[model samples]
Target: MSRRIIACEVFKPYLDKLLEESGVEAVDYLEIRQHDHPELLARSIQSIIDETKDVDEILLFYGLCGNAILPLVSKGIPIKVLRVHDCAAALMGSNAAYRKRFEGNPHKRYHCLSYGERDDEYFARTSPEYRKISEEYGEDNADYVFSMLYDKFSTPVTYIKLGLDGEESQIRRKEEGYYSVIEGDLGLLRRMLKGDDDHVCVTLHPHEKFVGIYDYEEILTTVNRNHDREKTREE
Candidate 1:
């Protein structure tokens, strides 16, 4: 069956690596930009679905980002989504690992990496939408909006490494309040891309609509099993 992936642009670097490593060919992608404006991504996803009528399954390199993927799934081709709340989980390598690190307030912390944001070029600051918000709501209100949008990476933040290389790693290391880099595994991504489906993927058949992430038990179960296997291998 032909497979396609509709991935967030933020996942580019990791996706590139996984594709090279997995050696799975015949995958296509619709790159959606990060940020909370779900409508744009929703539209992009729909456009791809319309264009790729021959695809047997669609894998989304997305989380249940602010209900962005909620409206995209339907009764047509099967859609596969990672069992994650956001891309941070993907970088952490699993939802369980992501939860363990940012246990207190999952939404308030940002996982800084080159693929997401390490050089501080946050999306909201430079996006055209930010300028539009400033014009419509005034600079004061715009800052407020930006703050709320990226409140996770707020002041006095600690950085954890998600395995992205280069200066971002160094900056994260020397900076105060920064935690040691926690290495992340790419096994889940590689499995999903290859249609392995051992765990960590929630497949929605055609004619079914995604209600919420409560439907992701199978995925988590699989990831947990994978984790166990990895531990055994290490031992």
Candidate 2:
């Protein structure tokens, strides 16, 4: 059966590479652009689900994403989503791997993104971007927007090094904040694309709400219970 993956635009490059490398045939994608808006994301996801009613085993390349997935349980179809807080964990392959980076540093406000995403003006928040936002919504509104979203973060925006060079990394860093580098691997993404196993994934059954899954126990319980359900269905 052909599978589908609805992913965020931020993960487009990574997902493209993983799917290509995995050689997973007949897989389709729907990329949503709502990194800053969770409501739109939820609506987009539901629309995609409605559009792809015939498709089974749909994969979502999303995390809790500010509770956007809270309302996106199952709409009578089986789907798999990573047990992660955000794409940061997906990029690192797992929550443990993503958290391991902060074992020593322990910066809660740490933000990670791909180098290619640095150019998105929506994420820029200054210069041409800020001017654009200010013109469209006024300077006061712009400040309010930034304050509500990005102001909470204090540490340098950490860029996940994914085979990019130092100069490119430097360009991606915002001038107002500092910069740091960390290695990233697509192991989890590859596994998902390759359909190797569900070790790092949780399959949601019909009508099951995806509240959140923070630890291995949560993942195991959800996945294992789903496995049993599948077995029962087969029987």
Candidate 3:
């Protein structure tokens, strides 16, 4: 069997390009890529289960906003890999309140929060500016966003994209890690997904490696999808 790596929404193209050069097989590069947020992610995760007839290794990318990742960890997956990334502009202006919330739970799992204002508020929560952002968003801004990020990060994320499915996703899972789902068949997924063998396949990534992240800009120069440039301008 070939060592597969499935790239989610944002990282799919870059991974695809790399494979083109590496002569690597890119499976569900398109399948698992998803929009931001927890609900979408959960749906996407479920879809892979429904589509893939076999279990396989998966590589999943994630921001620090969803809360679902934690639950996925508790559940069973072959080998879950969580991608973590932090943005530079997002780190500015935060208060101690934000730090206390996230920093206290440092031991569980730490990944990049993606690049944006949300992550900025997330990182600077303890910097004294956190409260200000939270005040504008809410007292629980960090907690809420973090939870959402993890939700999308975890599972049940929906496929907001066009032209993707389970088999393609499996190919990627076999290669890269998607969410908490590692590469495994129905038998292995039964323990966690609670579905029939014919129903779903699991794609798991190692949180250690998944959580381990580098600058995305460095890897892919042209990664503009799903994210709303207009929204950024509005913010």
Candidate 4:
């Protein structure tokens, strides 16, 4: 069956490499800026899905993503979503793997290639909330607010290397403060692309909606329309 991929732009570089190697095209990348508002992110994805035609299936390169994927509903075409909390977990290959590393270390920030490339200003500039704060409260207050919201935790950053050549040097050079590097496995993504529905993906069939369980294991599931209707009738 013909397939298309809807992925976050943050994964573009890595997905580009994978698509090139696999010779699979037909992918759409959405802006990372939408991540500032999960609701908007979900709407943007639904818009893309609404516009998609001729594709038998859509492969989403995303995680629960602050529940952004939770509202997505499949119509005629089925959607396969990566089963993880976010891109960081996807890079680590699984939710369990990510939890093993950082479950207890909640203060540590996880950095990847895309995250490493952007500076603090880039994030602040991209965030609409930050812009509003800056406009209303002034730049200094905005900085303080964001720093309190995002930079309160003090710990060495953990950089995940996705096995790309020259990535280590680039990340090491850009990352400030103490940091550690760990090899990231793309095996889960490879499996997803290969259509191996073993455990790394949750497939939403036509009329089914995605649901986030808010846990490390069983990260997401699909709610069938029939089941929802039954529940509504019972209620």
By summed lDDT, the worst window of 10 consecutive residues in model 3 runs over 86-95
Task: Work out the TM-score per prediction.
Answer: 0.71, 0.73, 0.32, 0.88
lDDT of 2 by residue, 55-156 (tens): 667787777778776667566777777667777777766778777765566454443444334434444566476688899999998788776656666556
All models: lDDT? 0.63, 0.64, 0.34, 0.82
The true-structure Cα RMSD of candidate 1 reads 9.6
Once superposed on the true structure, which residue ranges of model 3 sit more than 4 Å away at CA?
1-4, 29-34, 63-65, 73-77, 83-235
lDDT of 1 by residue, 157-194 (tens): 43445465653645545456543445777766777787
By lDDT rank, best first, the candidates go 4, 2, 1, 3
Model 3, 14-118: lDDT tens digits are 344445655656455432223345566655554553444344543333323243332333122343333222211112111122243345444322222121122
Candidate 4: regions farther than 4 A off: 120-136, 175-177
- Model 2, runs deviating above 4 Å: 24-33, 102-120, 123-129, 140-152, 164-177, 213-235
* lDDT score, candidate 4: 0.82
Candidate 2 weakest lDDT stretch, 10 residues: 216-225
Choose the strongest candidate by lDDT.
4
* Superior by lDDT: candidate 2 or candidate 3: 2
Write the residue-wise lDDT of candidate 4 on 12-114 in tens digits: 7788788889996967889876877999999999998888889889999988999998888887788899999898888888888899997788887877777
With a 3 Å backbone cut-off (N, CA, C), the pairs that clash in candidate 1 are 75-206, 75-207, 76-206, 108-152, 199-222, 200-219
